[model samples]
Target chain A: MPAVVVGPGVASGASPVVSVRQVGFGYDGRPVLKRVSFDVGAGDFVGVVGPNGSGKSTLIDLIDGILQPQQGEVLIAGRATREYRRRDLAREVALVPQSFALDFDLSVREVVEMGAYCRARSGEVRGDAEWTLARLGIAELIERRFTELSGGERQLVVLAQALMQRAGLLLLDEPASALDVSHQLRLFDLLRDLNADGLTVICILHDLNLALHYFSKLLVLSDGELAAFGPPEEVLTPETVEAVYGVRAYMHRHAGRTYLTYSPRLRGERKGRIHVVCGGGTGAGLMRELVDAGWEVSAGVLNALDTDEEAGRELGLRMVVEAPFSPVGDETHTENVALMRTADLVILTDVPVSLGNARNVEAVCTAAREGVRVWAAEGVLAADLAGATGALVESGVELHADTAAMLAALTARDGSQRPA
Target chain B: MIRLGRTSVWPGIVLTAGVFVVCLLMSLAFGPASLPLARIWHLVTAGPVAGDLDSAIFWQIRLPRALLACLVGAELAVAGVIMQDLFLNPLTDPYVTGVSSGAALGATLGIVLHVAQFPWMTVLALAGGFATLGIVWMAARRRGRVNIFILLLAGVTVSYLASAVVTFLMIKAGDDMHAIVYWLMGSFSGRGWTEVELALLAVPLMLIPLFRTREMDILLQGEKRALELGVEVERTKRLLLVTAGVLTAIAVSVSGIIGFVGLVVPHIVRLLVGPGHRGLLPVSLLFGAAMLNVADLMSRTLLMPNEIPVGVVTTFVGAPLFVYLLRRGKA
Candidate 1:
């Protein structure tokens, strides 16, 4: 089929250069994205937002030519993403993925120059990296090692690298997840300026305020499906945000802008004995294993029924689940941990440490020293447990990768115990 | 920590010059022929002294072996540096890509079939290395790109299969076991100038192109990122891999299977210096040349007249360092 160009979200009469028609994506026959279709127009800045794992990264990969859609095609400038040469597509579209591996000491300028890659001919450099750096206002950071840059600065450098190609389409996956307020504003301004200059931008953002104030269009994804599409106010309503993110949110107006505070569907208030440092799919298998093994597994702070918590629910385990995804609250951490002490064995599942739940690793370490079986997972990146598990490891507790191994020792067959 | 200022290439050059002199002196002083320095000098300064058997042995046998060590060592280290760069992995040396394995499998074919007794060793090694590399490259490639995540896994598979073919040949050759395994493990003893001259022909041809492009620095950005930057990512990576394979195949053809010089030397140099292959390559070349000569010296002296395979001696030293580096912050 010829690419369907929609003019609805496009500026007045400007038609979409790239459009999707009833595209569905799944992995290993399990559907994550279903019958999804959206249009990206000329100079349009579309903000695709959803909770984590809502097919945001997957969609970007598909658009970037790293992955092929099993059902429908991703069109660029009315042509299939693959029909054009990989370089040709690169010249037209640029991707700024969130993953950062600054292993080699490539300077910021060198990274930005990498943006002009597809357009660069052998024995010749376009020298467009300078202009790109100048545009991002990171011209001063050009010669500095990329790893030495701050989190906010690194984000800008990556943006410069992505935009230096002068690609018409820019696909950013969660551009401001770890930025401070000032940096987030600066990043948004950069995106807005680029959009105003006739560059089509698609930014994946989690903040509703930024999307409402900055982006001209919004695309909300839920469980890998398109939950809502249109202007920020229309799509940022309590119902849409709640349905997309699975929580109860109140849309309140402040300084002529609508801000949302989402609260999850509350279960009955309870005080129980079970301290758990649980998050991510890292704990999914172990949570089921423990629950099925007949332990009272009450999770300390799970945002909601994540893939892991979903497994917990299937096994009929009573977890002190956090409702932050559905409800915005400061008391969720306190409330969840109140029930943490009731558990006899404090199991520390191997979850990656980030600013999001860095304290969870700490909680396990503290509980383990108080005579809890604090077996750490091997094969976990030290950076993931940078702050929390270090002290526990020093205190004679070993860091292991397999929870099954840890569980086996905790529930040993017969009687051969090591010096714990 | 007195910061060793920046690693000066001048220091490397001077150190390399010093290492060359020491190797020359050691080459002259010891070996099968007990040479006196005065007589060696007299043989060089004066045209063929009356009793210059020691000098002839030194000039004909030791000099070539030492030079061959320089060439093979430099070639293997540079090949390793390039392989690590292409993979964007510091731990992935040349063997991980199955380049050396391919060459060994190739050379072993000729040796087992008695074809290697003639001049078919290079042909077989080149054909085997290139062919296995081709099979590996094809199998590992997905969507016109070398997916190293799977490429490493595929290389392991290729190495396994090729080594099995080699093991099969070793079993069949039975009586030639000493010759087959010794050459396969690699050795540089008793080599002459002709072999050294033959090896010099291949090393410079392969390394010059790599030095010119200086692609390792750019390649570390990533294949997709590098491609986007106007680097013909697929072609450049393939060329780099092929050059490295050819260099390694040449080294294997000369030295047999001198293991870990390609793996540990580049990594050791990188730890001392940094990951910039431009400087790292030259530095590793010197360090590797020095290391192999020293190891060869130890092997010859440790068991007088009955030398161990220089390859086994290196692994004995390298495996410990490999484990040490793995623990020390991936340093």
Candidate 2:
């Protein structure tokens, strides 16, 4: 029988549910996890996130008593895992594996009932398999053959099996890796409900955004060591993400939930500066491309709440922002011109011309006349250019159909100017 | 919550038991000297009448042979289920690891060297079986893990080597070639009470695996998952392999390599009742017993005074049925 708890809330100073004290593990003399230590309190939904082969799965195995650490011990419920009997540990920790294929044609109920093997007597599964399957919203799959279910359905059934064990602590290894978006949300919702009912869940999530959305705490592993462990808001900061994953990430909050978006950093030395004259969501992709190619990027005359402004701010690019729904003011235009004057190249994006920001086209023409190399992106002139297209074309502005063509032109120009 | 009633396996069990009795009766009644069913039934209920040919044949020859067939069939089929479940491969059998070829080589050596006596042959066969299994294991181990594909390849290689040696020994036994060749073909002819007793020894040994059905069920989900579920995977594997090896050794000693009964009966039972060992094991035992008894009867009566080898009959019946099952399962 499972030990009954008071409720979902963990009292202050409650004993730790899981404790890893200086544990180290290796395979065939090569280390996979090194001296990892952390504590998980009761009723905590903790997510373990790391790059592939960074020892996240190995840490789960250690806590579940599947793999013993070579250097230090792992304690569950204040006792060493090695000190517990196999069935006793199983009753306390239940693991829903990533995926498992069955050779035999066993019914889903038969597979779920196997979880009760530790508690039941010989040839008997103590728990009601149907009840558990129903609780997971898979009662219809009870009599279905396990091998015939879809991947997402199989994962849900596996979760049902784990629940049948009635374990207080649940360990899931990439439970949402094979699920569709809707199914992933369903599974996380189920997990949250279970956690609300007093289950301590430690899930290894490969999707960082999903982890941020569902977990209260995050344990970040990098190169076999613990990089950070705290509330998701604290542990998933820009610096820690870059250090651990070698990528730049932005954490956004909407409706009181955190979301993470990341972009790969450029390699090698910095390229020359480029000013992008774009707005209304057209210049966001161009700005990211410039940043990734090692160029110092600046965008301007964007309305305050434009998507391009948000992308610029997220990527930390220099920008001249105007008030939303207003014409471009002289102050913003002057700021944009000053930014363009220092640039080695200026880019005109395909954003539609409107009365609110038609001065952006004039700014680009002035920059081109002043000897700044201007590259007019293909779709910009095709859209509404506010009758400034012909003058800009005659002003010695280069034309390119896409970002790839413009990048090639820039690289060729850079190569030609190296001697100077 | 929907309360889907649990499907009981009792009805299937009772139905198979009824079929088993019919097969038993059929095996008792048909032979070269065809006995009447009424007279055979009377002989079964009453003691053998003196100086009666029907009673004499039923008690001494037909009855013992059928009983031996049933016992050996149960042993081999249960061994197949254990081996298949252990490896998690559907095509595996009691002899997949070269145990039968090893037994054949041992029996041939016993015959060529004039040590073909009762207990010596059995002991030699067992020694040979374990030795072949050891060689296969050693050949398949890599970096401290047993790769099952390598093990299958090694088993095939060792089987060929053992069969070659057995053929060479038979060639050397020119005068005793008929005895060695007939034994290699595998027959239940002239088998009597002693062979039945020898086969009965495997029943308790067979129970060891039956008692481990729960662990075997977990093991069917791969070894790593079984470990996480708190099964002592290594220990369970070792115990099941040793028991299966011994069971195969015993069956080979008495029956001289009955081919395809072990391989086919379990698959047939699995198709009939689903593959939970709680149902699969008992059904395989009964179905294996009935199938082999029916095969032996056909082997004796099909040619009428010729008596083909029971192994040959089983191969002819089992191979085609296995193919049908494979295609049907795929479809």
Candidate 3:
């Protein structure tokens, strides 16, 4: 979709466009990036994501040759970055900064032409500027004043300015952070088209979802260290997200695409532990809500690949997991019972009644008989075995219609027990 | 020539050059002893005869003053553009860096020391201006890179300190008060070919910004963005600050602290041709010369023998025009 082919000559096909080797940078003795090493290969689209103050912006500056690493080196095209002159490095790498505010009245055409400041003045400079603007689908903005454009339009114009440099490697620092959703998509799409034409891009962004959706590779930074690097799916695992961001994340596949949704790990004062007897996909939501509500939740008798088992694992909960689609064997049943015996209360979700998971109900009844409070929803599982259900009823087990009603009952019971 | 909107910057530059030519001729021809246009043309054609009074006034008096005005005007305007862009503040002027105030202090000292003669005052002012620049430079340097924000604050602080000393000297000197006051008021009245030659020294420095027009334009977005875009920002900034400081020193040394032209000419040229430095720098240079020439002409002619200060005429003409431009909403 680009109007012109703007890229470096493919001569350095053997070396990565960027190489940061054991680079460590600091400001005033405060480290910003510590022993970070990564190589961005030719024609790669890389997205850099990190929490605030994780050296994402500093990393870009180092790679752009604006900041030198105190300990290690950055090599562009297998040459030491410090060796290249500023103009020569610019010809090899272009950066579209996060934001620019021009106070003077300057036309977009004039602003874009400034991108060729280091290049010798030729007639092709104007043609190149026009083509770059056209490639970004903003040819009409050439005559508009840069100060008068919307934030989205201004970012696109600035991107056009960087493209006018015709460099192979392009770095953007949160270029889409100020844009609306539609504009963000439009900007990424333009970046994609440009990348398809062999423009190597490394963008630093805060939106992890957008990073996963667009970039081929993701470099995650945490506390001034490279936390993970590789393909998005391989690198942005739930465990990595929790470790780096102190939050629980659920990876979901919907409509043939993978994405993640996050929940904050609100670690408040210690609440009493509760054991959940759930199977299939029914208890994932309940487990998350209970964890968020300051309860230490444990789940049991779940098959290894079950949705609830994955959710519990992602939440870092202690769970008794069994093999997939297998009957609750004696070992896991005893483990589930021991888990319930340690919990202050046991809650059973309305999972489908099946012979394979029939022992989960019996495990709850056994815990109740042994002097632990047991709670269950009146569902197919409770009704399947009348003898077990009758024994549970006789042992003072509380039954609610659904999760909300059951949660309300639990909240009321806690409030009565511990009044403020 | 660059195009902004539907119009090309060529027309603006051409028109300003045309106006500068007219201002040049008028400033040379019309004064207290006004020469007829035909007679002025004949004198120019005759070319600097040694013994005639009218010819002496035309060649020896009016011509050099006009040339000095044009040179100093161009220097200030170029310095203004550099300072405004370098600081990324529209309120920035050539004197904002404290160089002019330093020059004024040196000129005041020259008056007080009874060395208020032609070259002594000029030399002392240049020394004072450069010394102030060195002081501000050291204050802003951090790890070999200049911080413009810190530089601005330091310049302002130094400017106030120098101004306080100038005020004290003005209050102390009884006999030399009028001489110091007249020099401070800024007139091109008795500046002959010597001052004109001294002002001409800054002409090459003025052209330095023209070559870096593109870099100056890119710097409008700020230094970080300029660096990312591949500009040698620290080097460019060092060169530009020194250029602006030197130009300001020379201009202020020749003409004592002429205001408004340095502050307002760049803005007007920017409003006319947009802020592309390819257009902004050259157009502002020509327009600044023209505006100051006309202001100097009006100062000599408006009240005739009693002549108003050229700075007052420039402020009187410039202040209203600047406000009008601001109200037009494009600035």
Candidate 4:
């Protein structure tokens, strides 16, 4: 058969390059992919991500036509994948599997040449074996044995073979799993270059950061079902991640790029609630430790755009904020007092006191006087607080030298509150 | 003329073909009653004149025996290549997969039944071989997938069972025991035009895999990977398995259970050329023919009147060479 010269999605005319319609596949009656439906347009770079056993690899297999769906169908180039001959479908889609049984001693050139097995000699639209290897920057490996190369090099050679097919659509199942950081970056960079040249790529990635950073779109799967699918920023939201992965995660935008940070939810281990009065990034580390140690923490009276406020917001803490560079207003002070009133303990970070933020120290002292446990990091605030520090000592607020001493003092206090 | 470079296999193919031609001529000339090279060439050109002693010796006996050995050797070696690649195990050979043992059982049965005639023994051997292949195939199949490890295990298990049955038949054949023992030892001695004709069927079977060289090369990665690379893995596997089975059955019927040649020729050829089936398959085929005929030539002429079984000759020559190549390969 003559080679089908489809440019990316041209084989389907106006349709998508890949249309997976309600596909369900199972092995030995155990379902792996269930009713999964999606479409990849021409030149789309998509990353498939999910927890282990979430049908990520199985979806790649279905898309590349290695395994047919037991229910519904996968259509490549608008034709049902099973209807096309193996060679013809190969001309349309090429897959780089994670690994293969490679015990045979074959030269790199021979293995790469096998990619052109389906096409006629004259129709080798992708260039020769050496040319393809040269394109991958591994042309010197042409005469080397495949089994003699390193894991990353073998993967690159296999990728070169897949490219030699000149398929419009490429599917990779964790192609970066065995690669080092540098090679992983190189592999994805090459994939992006090929995608820019009108090749549609759908890769199954284990690293969510890489997925968000490299791919134009993300397909999130959970428990053999589609969790979400859209642009990476929209599809991989904190709510979706927490719901699907059962972990608390938040996104922060820095330099126009979003990064996701995750913290495990200690279910049923809710330690007592504590309100931390902090600023200038001092509370960031303490807040993270408290949260990880099962303390339900809230922060208060931080100025807008303060470092601690950013950390608090990134950690998804309930925080009371004042205007930037402005004094803590009476309303915000009242909110901070209300938060401290319900707390089992109140933590005060060592921020240099001034008229603008003096209310935070006052609120901590008031909470301490009202039978709430209060711990403060000792600072020059001992001198700067002046009469306020004296009042704090009189109110029975325990001041520790640093966070370690404070945490130790808190652990020693345990369930009992000492008398003032 | 063999080019040891990475590019073309034409020179390797030409070299092996030349070796085959030399071995075939040498095999025809140096048997029990030796014929001069010039006289042998005249007799071959004269083409089987009647009532001529040298012509009868050349055409009726030596020519057919040599051709039968060459064909059977080529058949077994090609079968070995297919089976080894299909099973994806370097240790696999045609006999280890139970096909040859099953054929041996059928031949043993034919010898015991006093129907050791031309076609009956060959037919029954073929039927037995296919039956074992079907049984092993079923044993390895689960839900529709053929598990290769299980297939190899089943092949070895079935091989043992058939060998056990052949042993029992040998113990039971009191008067016909000598003929059974001689057949079990595997020889191309006294085999003539009829056996050559039967062995000629393997030529087409051997040629079938040449068209599938690309698929076979892809399969070196494995079946699942081959499928992803656009090879119809199951269909190709079925066709190659059947070809190997038929070749083993026909060869076993004509020349009995010859060992070593099938197992070692592929490894030798692979060392000479690379493992690309384009070079590996044809080179192994031609080299197998050359190797076996030389082995046969040595077997018939070694002790003058008393001939050792050709199987012993191959084992003696092949075993040391295989170990040396293996150690050298490790280095």
lDDT of 3 by residue, A339-411 (tens): 9999988998888757788888888888888889888888744546334454557766778787777778777
**Residue clash pairs of candidate 3:** none
Which 10 consecutive positions of candidate 2 chain B have the poorest summed lDDT? B1-10
Better of 2 and 3 by lDDT: 3
Ordered by DockQ, highest first, the candidates read 3, 4, 2, 1
lDDT of 2 by residue, B1-331 (tens): 1111236667667778888889989999888777778988789888778898888999999999999899988889999998888777777889888888888888888888889877777678767887888888788777666666777788889999999999888888899899888888888987778778888888988888778888888999988788777777767776787778778877887888888988888887777777888778888888889989999999999998899999999999899998887677667
Flag the better candidate by TM-score, 1 or 2. 2
Judged by whole-model lDDT over C-alpha atoms, candidate 1 comes out at 0.70
TM-score of chain A of 1: 0.61
Task: Provide the lDDT at A159 for model 1.
Answer: 85
- Candidate 4 structure quality by residue, lDDT tens digits, B1-331: 1335457888889999999999999998997788989999899788989999999999998999889889988998999899888888888898866888888888889999999887888787777787888898899888777777888899899999999998899899888889888887899988889889988878999999998888998998888788777888878987888788888888988888898888999988887787888888898899989989999999999998888999999999999998888777777
Native-referenced Cα lDDT, model 4:
0.85
Would you list the rank order by TM-score, best first? 4, 2, 3, 1
Top-scoring candidate (lDDT): 3
Please give the range of 10 consecutive residues that has the lowest summed lDDT in model 2 chain A: A1-10
Docking class of 2: medium
Q: Looking at model 1, give its docking quality level.
A: incorrect
- Proportion of native contacts kept per candidate: 0.25, 0.60, 0.74, 0.70
